[model samples]
Target: MLKPSIDSLMTKINSKYTLVTVSAYRARRLRENPELFQKSEKSTSVNYVGMALEEIDSEKLTYEVRDKDETTS
Candidate 1:
């Protein structure tokens, strides 16, 4: 089973696309530097992606969606 279920992740991030984007970004960071993980001791996940999901479920990691115009630099 997934450590952090998709349903729980959806509560933290509204859209599936955004959730995937944010988790993937965070997972990459975790893979590059495992030190970025805050729930290492508590998290049951053994991989970076699972850890990223756990972080989202625990509200430890978050993403901000900027205005559309702001992204159009």
Candidate 2:
């Protein structure tokens, strides 16, 4: 079973789209550099996608909300 529930993950992230975006980004990073992030032995059962979700669920990985005006400038 997935350690972090969907509800929990959703709470950390603003929207489902954002969750997917963040998780995908983190998963890609993990694939490129496995040594950068540390995972518990239990995480071995799941693949990188799950690992990424776990990181977000645990608060190990976080995202910042940027104002639209900042990006538009």
Candidate 3:
């Protein structure tokens, strides 16, 4: 019989994770109070059409305003 090392066991433990589904309202609730959930930093790159997120200072933050002026010839 062979035994796995401590590092191998730790790697297995870190590799496994559980995911849960939440409704939009429930998501809002969770977002409003992030301290209630086990938090993790998620890094993602997104290509948006017209809006840009410049800051997120608070739990419920919003982006800045942009002027939309499209002149049709």
- Clash number by candidate, in order: 0, 0, 0
Candidates 1 and 3 compared: the better one by lDDT is 1
lDDT of 2 by residue, 10-63 (tens): 889979999999999988998898775657655643577888988888788998
Q: Please, what are the lDDT tens digits per residue for candidate 1 over residues 1-73?
A: 6657788789899999999899999999999999889975678988988889999999999888799999898
Provide the lDDT at 29 for model 3.
49
Q: Across residues 36-70, which tens digit of lDDT does each residue of candidate 3 receive? A: 33322431312210001101211222323245654
**TM-score of candidate 1 on Cα atoms, chains taken together:** 0.88
- Stretches of model 1 off by over 4 angstroms after superposition: none
Candidates in order have lDDT scores of 0.88, 0.82, 0.27
Best by TM-score: 1
Model 1 steric clash pairs:
none
Backbone clashes counted, model 3: 0
TM-score of each: 0.88, 0.78, 0.21
